[model samples]
Target: MDTIIQPVARPSKRGSYRRHSDEFKRAVVAQSLLPDASVSRIARQHNLNANQVFAWRKLFGEGQQESGNNVCTLLPVTVVASVMAQPVAEQAPACGGIIELTVGKARLRLEGAVDTAVLHLVLQRLLP
Candidate 1:
């Protein structure tokens, strides 16, 4: 008995390219910004790359900041005096007290009073 050989099939040459609408990208970016949301998980659910979502978020955030919509602004801070058993002069130290600052995901512990210029520089470096 003679056996017939079949020709092998070849893959398609055209590549698949998907285009997403700005509205869709905005919605996905918004979803990714939700508290406790996972970018990888969201991307997987939407059949998108995590990096793409991150890029969209960065672009959206920059636009908002440029428009002064999501710009970071300082609010009035109130400091209250704590009552102590010892006299104020005796209890007070030569240097100022410690200050804890939470900037983004960074936690900074600074002992004594920080200089205005130094603090400004530190914050500028710490922030994006």
Candidate 2:
């Protein structure tokens, strides 16, 4: 008995080809953020399918927060990075040797003059 082999079908350039660079991919993902900008427009501009652009958008959106957090940790750089990354809006004005920071409407009071050592202890307890 003889067995027949079938050739694999290739994607057609007219309906299948999609080209994207690192810069283009980032731009497309960013531009696709607006509710009005259809995925097709972004993908077409970058020679990509609507589905491809949509996927990129989703991946990048989900990753943005994690990437920002990594910058805060900066384990490979400096330990101070984590402290410095504290969001300013969450911090309350220091008064009478006390400082307050809010986390989701829950008040985190840092009492007394917050020296580096004390701050470190507080961070260890609060963050860890």
Which candidate has the highest lDDT of all?
1
lDDT of 1: 0.74
Tens digit of lDDT per residue, candidate 2, span 1-128? 99999998998667564565767777777777756877788778766778887687676663453333343432222232223444555665544554555533345666654566777886676552
TM-score of candidate 2 versus the correct structure, residues matched by position: 0.37
The Cα local distance difference test for each model comes to 0.74, 0.62
Estimate candidate 1's RMSD in Å. Answer: 12.0
Displacement of the residue 59 alpha carbon in candidate 2, Å: 2.5
Clashing pairs in 1: none
Task: State the local distance difference test value for candidate 2.
Answer: 0.62
Q: Please provide, for model 1 over 1-128, each residue's C-alpha lDDT reduced to its tens digit, 9 standing for 90 to 100.
A: 99999998998788788899988988888788777999999999999999999999898772352333456756344454564566534654536666666755678777874565788898888765
What's the distance in Å from true for residue 95, model 1? 60
Which residue ranges in model 1 land beyond 4 Å of their true spot? 1-6, 14-16, 62-68, 71-128
